[model samples]
Target: MAQNILINDLPLEIFIKILKEVDGVSLGKCRRVCKKWRDGIDGSDQIWHEVCRKEFKHSSEIAKRKAGNICRWYHIYKNLKMWIDITTFDKKVREFYKFSLHDKSHALDVDYGVLPLKDAKGVVFYDMSNLKYIPVAISETNCCKVTNNDHVSVILTKTGLYVQKCVDSNGVTEGFFKAENFVLSGEVIYFHNGTRAGELLLYRLSSQKKGPMSRPIFDTLAILPEGKFAVQLDVCERKNGPLIIASTFFEIILVEYDFFPHEQEPKCSFPVNKLTMYKRLLRLKDRLQSS
Candidate 1:
């Protein structure tokens, strides 16, 4: 009888090469086969790096560019992959809350002291510290987004946009500005009326004064030529300052607004056919409706 060779009997290099062919999920399953397999998979970071690069391309790119020496690529990728698996596989709901509105997008924001929840009718600020719900703007609301710090919030309607300051104890203050589509950064909110093609308006708030009586003071930073039909705003803070990214129907524009020594023009712009995509989506929706 001819001698039979098992998979584990293969050379370590060849075994590792075989393991690299499969994904993280398959590799995880393989690790359970034997102690040798587990040691082979767990001992190498290169395998995880390759896996991360393949699956989490975007996240890997961000980790490479932004995350410094503090974060290891393999570790970040492993945690993220594990998180995705848990979230995707786990069917149980950890927490649940009842709300009146049906639409959930742009409806909830959480901060240290308060939690702001938006509905079609109005916005309700829930004080986490005191356990109280404070209602603000009882009128009909189309869309709303809150700031990261939870100190500011912007509400949108058919006519205009309303920016409100959420105070700790007293109540929500008046609108910071009644503009159109807006996005909140740290202390600044960017918006545009959509009347002027490629016009972007930026407003910075001063949080020097605190309390319900002392409201945030809004000042005009600049009115930039961003893009035609500006629809979205995104902000990222770098070493320089807050980097504003605005996406319009035609393209996406980036602006580095350093307040100390102001840079007038936008840093860069990328052409994107978002309008075409929107139209295609609408047509598809119509066809589905008709079908």
Candidate 2:
């Protein structure tokens, strides 16, 4: 006859090793088993880190950086898990609204509980919280696309790109060049300049103070191959830095902006200047065939 061993009797090292192999949900259940188990799980940051690594492989580092040094690993894990659940889970439609407008409305951009929609008159901000349309006066009637963040709204028209403060609509800053298409990620705008050379430009919304009279300026990032113009653009912040995904008629380009290296250096040291911030990671031609 042999005596049976209880799970609680296991050594701390062996216990943590076993818990590490379990999924996040299972780990949560184990933490509720008893005081000893909860303390054991919560005390080890490695367990939470491992959970985050397995759950959010692509965004773990980015989340950790945003959380800062004082934030605990468990809190970071919970926040990321919540965001994943909110974004990925499917839910039935609760309600819908029909709006009468002149001409077909352009693509709308939503951020921070506000959605900006472009109609015949101008760009109207639909407040998600209050359920009201606050029209922002835009002179350009032929608006192509509209996007915004918490700070400012960017309107792309056939003639030029316009940036206006979200609070004060009176001060509108117009770009010097015409853009075929553009994407707004936070304070940065990545756009395709409507030119034969297929030039991609970057405009920083936060750098308005650096320009004359506090106006934003454009920086030429990269130039695509001749005859290949970018029709669509997307930007996302990754562990490394900001990544731009641009799709042309024939090819898809992945460009990464390296801002971390320069950011890490001391402010007193001379800035490490580069020719261009755009670093092409991968270019796939005939994406449909390649897939």
| RMSD to truth, every model | 21.6, 20.9
lDDT of 2 by residue, 1-291 (tens): 999999989999999898889888899898899899999999998898888889877566555533223235675566555442332333222112223442333324333333444444544444332334443344444656655444445556676665544332246433334678876666677888745636666665544465456656665556665665556554433222333445554344545443333322132421111001000001101111122
Tally clashing residue pairs in candidate 2. 0
Candidate 2 accuracy as TM-score: 0.35
- Worst-scoring 10-residue span by lDDT in model 2: 274-283
The residue-by-residue lDDT of candidate 1 on 1-291, one tens digit each, is 999999989998888888778887787788899899888887876777778888887766554332222224544464455432221231211111334544424233333223444555554554332224533333344434433233444445555555444432256443434566666555577887755534444333323476779755543333445224335554332222334444444333445433323322234321122222223223322332332
- State each model's CA lDDT, in order: 0.46, 0.50
Clashing residue pairs in candidate 2, if any?
none
The TM-score measured for candidate 1 stands at 0.29
State the displacement of the C-alpha of residue 281, model 2, in Å, after optimal TM-score superposition: 35
* TM-score per candidate: 0.29, 0.35
